[model samples]
Target: MTDQTAPTDPAEVTAHLDARLDDDARAWFAESRDRIGDDPAAVRVLFPAVSRRVGRGPLAPGGDGDDPFVWHRDDAGRALLLAAVDPGARPGELRDCYTHGDARERRGVLRSLEVVEVDDEVTAELVDDALRTNDVRLVAAALGPAGVAVLDDDGFAQAVLKAVFVDLDLERIAGIPDRVTPELSRMMADFVHERVAAGRAVPASVWTVIDRHPPADRLAAIEAERDHEDPHRAAAAAAALDARP
Candidate 1:
């Protein structure tokens, strides 16, 4: 996502999104939204055409903070806005949207899972499906608040590790600080060792996970980085050590 400041208000963001659309796109969005109730397959038709109608630029910008739609492209964000207000967007229909979508459409569906009506099993399935992909965008979207709500602890940890594997920043994984486990700590520690053994720089996110769950043995490893050349890594290590009780 680009570095533009995100508009935190949902209503404001929606207004901004609508403002960006030209007359034809706005009319199409309204008509498609109306079609959701009368036509069962409306989303299937409308979802893919979003980019052509809405444009592919970043909808707002910056990463998801208070505003989840911030990171989405205009089309994806527009799709999400449609899904948000549509009462017909049930789990089965949403699942079909994901199943039939291209990566961008799938991302809109995945991020919408948290707000839409979906059972735990379907949520896990969608999240796992996205996690299994090599697409960093899909992987990142999968680990959103919906993933955190539905994934088991083990599954969540593995997803976080997957984000690290795909070079996504740890901050992008929603609620990760509250979700870390000893297993995740160990997994990240092992990753750090492997990178060091291979003469490679560890992914900066590896420290975020490890530092949050600082086991005694892992503290030494984290402490060792306190003097590392990268200021970010050094600060992370020092913060972890300083937090020791």
Candidate 2:
């Protein structure tokens, strides 16, 4: 996946992946990249071979802070593979790649959306398909920056609600701050209400989204969170209330 450091720019990502590879793997990667460029159909074969060819370790190691995008070595390889495809054929290839490939391959296609050029409708369909699945990893991959860029307001809010339904960490869905809407706040509040009524614990991460788009007239649910037994939820509610206009 793309990050602030790499931003999914194919050239930058290639360089990042190249620097981490040993001499032999690096050579293989370069050859594969060019081979896919020459014969776009070859990507079907090379796409799944990335993890074996390049290590599966994080391309950039995480540290103590808000987690940056952690691209596995194979993820970068796959993105580069997509980038190597002829732009005219890339959309069809991407759709096939997502359809035929297993979960990880599908995730790679979703995460690599920004790096490869394609029709918005094509990416939208892929994102929609991923969001419909019960697979948590695939769902999370679909809500990432690439997916975020393509989803409209209602679709995005529903996706966030879907994350809650499947118990995904809201933090994993990047670009939430910029994408938040009152509809999202309402949906999150409804979720909070259901959980509270059922005596189920609310995910603390949901509060982050609520705080971001705190509905002007519906502060009660969020305000009530101020005294939540979980200190994290309590603090998030306190912040949301204190910041309320």
Candidate 3:
């Protein structure tokens, strides 16, 4: 493994990779990196190592003629390998090293791969993976009003609500309406009820949606449904209902 911290710049890294691999190796590098995610830095580091092991040829003699050095089964292996050696390196950089490294060297490099920061949203998105797999702390770090709306629409409302409860406040919730769909609005109401029931703080801005779309009785019914699962939520629903008068 080349010293990742060898004080090399982007240009130096690119030159090193180009000299070590041929046209076939370069093509595999591009394809593999694209399959993982877009991050040019990752490609720069992966190709040279691959070329070293596979001699710039396809993996099998007469198989699919695919670059056998590249580990297609491990989606994020390239990124993982790079991160193992250089803990402080960015996800993009690590991804580059694996995708551009030599074919023969690719397999051994992949075995060293690890999922160091599962909670990094940028890494998650770049790796073409789901953020829901992240911890609450990671989810909280990744979320904002816009991200929340995206997550909600993608059927990740539960995750979004969890993030909101942990990180968002009234001001943040106030901005949520702009991103809320009718479906998401209802989901948000349910989430708020859950929080209130748990004696967790409720962001007052959520009431804007509750007050605007659904009639009071309808809102009450939604709250009642939530209350069924949690008694404290029932009391909170009752209070919201009484306040409506």
Clash pairs (backbone) in predicted model 1: none
Q: Residue-wise lDDT of candidate 2 within 102-129, one digit each (tens)?
A: 8778877886885778888999999999
> Which parts of model 3 are misplaced by more than 4 Å?
1-91, 94-137, 144-152, 155-159, 165-167, 170-175, 193-201, 208-212, 215-217, 222-235, 238-245
Give candidate 3's root-mean-square deviation (CA, Å): 16.2
Considering summed lDDT, which 10 consecutive residues are worst modelled in model 1?
A: 1-10
Q: What TM-score quantifies how close candidate 1 is to the native fold?
A: 0.78
TM-score of each: 0.78, 0.83, 0.35
Instruction: Please report, in order, the local distance difference test score of every candidate based on alpha carbons.
Output: 0.67, 0.77, 0.42
List, residue by residue over 142-190, the lDDT tens digit for candidate 3: 3332233334344444544554555433223313445455665676676
Displacement of residue 210 (Cα, Å) in model 3 is 4.0
Model 1, 129-187: lDDT tens digits are 99999888778777767667788888888888888777887765777677888888888
Backbone clashes (count) for model 3? 25
Query: Distance (Å) between predicted and true CA of 51, model 1?
Result: 0.9
Best by TM-score: 2
Order of models, best TM-score first: 2, 1, 3
Report lDDT (Cα) of residue 233, candidate 3: 61
- In candidate 2, which residue ranges exceed 4 Å CA deviation? 1-6, 62-69, 216-245
